[model samples]
Target: MGTAGLKALLHRVRYEVLPAKSTEDKVLAHVPRDVVVTVTASPVKGLEPTLDLTARLAAHGYRVVPHVPARLLRDDRHLKEVAGRLREAGVDDVFVPAGDADPPAGGFEGALPVLRRLSELGSPFARVGVTGYPESHPLIHDDVTIQAMWDKRAYATYIVSNLCFDPRVLGEWLARIRRRDVALPVHVGVAGPVQRTKLLAMATRIGVGESTRFLAKHPAWFARFAAPGGYAPERLLTRTQEALTAPSAGVAGLHVFTFNQIAETERWRRALLDRLGG
Candidate 1:
């Protein structure tokens, strides 16, 4: 991609933040109101933290998209309550994922049922997002994952890819999805500038550890992130530029996983923007 196209993608980038104690303050201090912010729902903390932080961020004038994972909800009643809360807060966008919750809280075991419930509730939000895996999921078969996307096409407005380090894999996945006829605009997920140590520490704090199921299910991610040498997000972006800018890619923008390193992420983004001529 040309510098102009790269800059445009960066400009449309959105940050995904964990709903932790200090997340609200860090986002308020470092993130511009013009930038979109997506709050994550933690299985450990449940959906309360996600909803609370989203309401607070929306109040501050940021376009907030909260993760409303199916596993966290109890039933249709819970879904309605969640929707009502977001509507009261003026939130119009949400990202729904199957989530890591084992023995799902209620009837919803995956995103599709919750999506159907949302439509039954008259599609409360303007934009609803579902997860897409560029690489094979450790637990789910690749065929099954893509078929879920096909099943969800009628309900979801967009797709957000899971974080994948390999640009070639990302590009290939984009092409494959187009071939499959799932045409929703995609927000390619990428990690922000994060220290491996900091990332591991955050994971532990959030109840993920070496022996945790989270790490076990994402062994590939662990190996890549913990490998020798620093991880430069810009390099990944540069390598993936052509695929993203391609006409058939249908890429909407980027969804940066900050791991709550808000200041560092924002600084890195701005410096990159400046280096690319603002």
Candidate 2:
């Protein structure tokens, strides 16, 4: 990709944040309003924190998206209330996830059910997103995950892939998605620039089994960050340039897993923007 293309991809990058205390304020206070901030849900607690953070962020005039975990919603009334609250807050988008709850707290089993129910309820959300895995999930078969995404395509407006370290795998998997006629605009997830120790800790806290698989998928990357140094988000971004800019990839842009390291990630992105001089 050329400088202009790369700039376009980086300029409007989306940042995903957790529902931790003071995290929303820190992000809103420091990061540019241009960056779209998405809030994540915690299975242990439920969707309360996510929605609370979303409403606050929206009130602050920031473009915010909250993760709506299906397992956390108790029933249709719950879903309706959630939708109403978000809509009243001027929130237009939401990302639905199957969730990591041990056992669902409600009738909804997974993202598919929630998506269907939302559509049936005449949901107020303008854009709905679902997850995609570039690598195999530790708990589910790779084929099954792909097919699940395809089945959910009718209800989803876009796809946000989980974090993956290997560029080759990300490229090949996305290319395959394009070939299969699953042409949803994909916001590929990549870890933001963060120190190795904190990065791994955050990865564990997020419970992305793929994070461990990422290291196994590329020992060299693991080795580089295993010691005292930091991991550069650019290393991964530079490697997968083709998958991002290629038309066949149907790539939308970045969905950075900042892991609440908003300042660090924003610095990296700003430097890159200056370097590109656009």
Candidate 3:
């Protein structure tokens, strides 16, 4: 892709934020209204925080997508209420992941069920998103994750890849999905400008069960973030520019995992856009 195409991608990107006490203020203060803000559903806090933030952001006239993890919900009635609430709040998009909740809060164990339920409920949301694992899921086999997407293809409108640092892994995963005919437009997930200390602190609060298992699976996470001058998001983007922007890739846009570093993330995005001449 040329710089123009890359610039357009950077200009229209989604910022994923964890639901925290001061997150709303930071988002209102730093993020542009045109950019989509997604609220994450924390296993510890459950779905209320995610819904609340989504409603607040939507009220402010920002397009917001809330993470509705299947494991966090209780049942179909609860899903209907949640859908009704989102509709009333004016949200049109949602991201559904299997989630980190252990033993689940109810019968919903994976995203497919909730996704199917959403469709059964007349597909209330305009855009429904499912998780994509470019890297191997810590617990689930690689084939299983790919198969999960195929299973979810009927219900989900798009796929948001999880955080990944390697371009090769992302390319290979994208290839596999395309081969299997899972053609949903992908919003590639990348980490935003993050400070090592804050990243570590926030990881703990996301959910103990998932965090612990995830840390064990990717032991080098700390070292990568702790490296000299910290992790540079641009380097990854630069390397994957062509693949991501290719017509055949079916990439929708970028999904930045801000990790609640909203202000820093906004700053980094602006600076990167400037460098890209966006």
**Collision pairs in model 3:** none
Candidate 2 colliding pairs:
none
Give lDDT per model, in order.
0.86, 0.81, 0.85
Candidate 2 lDDT, 1-278, residue by residue in tens: 65676778898689888778879778877778888999887766678888998999888888999988888888889999999999999999999988767688888888998999888988678899999989777678888888888999999999999877778999889987776788789998987886777656754554332234345455565566666644567877877887778877877889987767888889999898898884
lDDT by residue (121-218, candidate 3, tens digit) is 79999899998989887788999999999999999899999878888888888888999999999999888878888767755553533323354468
Regions of candidate 3 where Cα sits further than 4 Å from its true position:
206-217
- Return the TM-score for each candidate structure: 0.95, 0.90, 0.95
Between candidates 1 and 2, the one scoring higher on TM-score is 1
Give model 3's TM-score versus the native structure.
Answer: 0.95
Query: What digit string (tens of lDDT, one per residue) describes model 1 on residues 1-278?
Result: 56777788889889988877899999999999888999888677789888999999999999999999899899888999999999999999999999888778888999999999889889999999999999888789998999999999999999999888898999999999899999999999988988788777766564331123344468677666667664789988988889888878999999998878899999999999999994
Residue 90 local lDDT, model 3: 97
Q: What lDDT does candidate 3 reach at residue 194? A: 81
In order of lDDT, best first, we have 1, 3, 2
In model 2, how many backbone clashes occur? 0
Error of 2 at 181 (Å): 0.7
